[model samples]
Target: MNQRAMIAATALTVMSMGLLAVPAAAQEKEKCFGISKAGQNDCASAFGTHSCAGQSKVDMDKTEWKYVAKGTCKDMKGLSADEAKKMKM
Candidate 1:
């Protein structure tokens, strides 16, 4: 292949690999609420106390959420996404 063609192919391969990686990573995670430790959350709280990750001030706060592996959040005593949404935080 010409240099330009080779480069295009390589770029396409890399892009495809990256695209494939996303779902695999997503499949390994789930958003679980009421389980975050103090200052160790993965994202913002539903109640709007914070707008970013790692900002929780209380441990196991019901409004805070973190990414846990699928099927493991309930095992950790954390609330599922639907349950968390219904919970009165």
Candidate 2:
């Protein structure tokens, strides 16, 4: 390969490796309910009141959640998905 082609190939390979690392890192996270501050939650509200991140309107709404490191939710006094489900009923 020409020098330009070779450099591009190397950069592309590095980027692909970074992409492959994302899923493994994601597995290290867990959703911890009732812990997010207003406008800071990661994704869909648990109560179906909203369906996007960073849209919570109240601090620490029990139906709002954000991703916490796996296994640390309880230490943070946050509920698990199962626990949140029960509370919503």
Candidate with the greatest lDDT versus the true structure: 2
Q: Estimate each model's TM-score.
A: 0.65, 0.69
lDDT of 1 at 61: 88
- The reply for model 1, stretches above 4 Å from the true place, is 1-27
Which tens-of-lDDT digit does each residue in 1-89 have in candidate 1?
Answer: 89999999999999999999998686878889998889999988887888999999999988899998788988989997678778874
- Cα RMSD (angstroms) for every candidate in the order listed: 4.4, 3.8
Query: How accurate locally, in lDDT, is each candidate?
Result: 0.89, 0.93
Whole-model alpha-carbon lDDT for candidate 2: 0.93
- Highest TM-score among the candidates is held by which one? 2
Model 2, span 1-89: residue lDDT tens? 89999999999999999999998787888899999999999999987999999999999888999888898999999999899989989
Residue 2, model 1, lDDT: 100
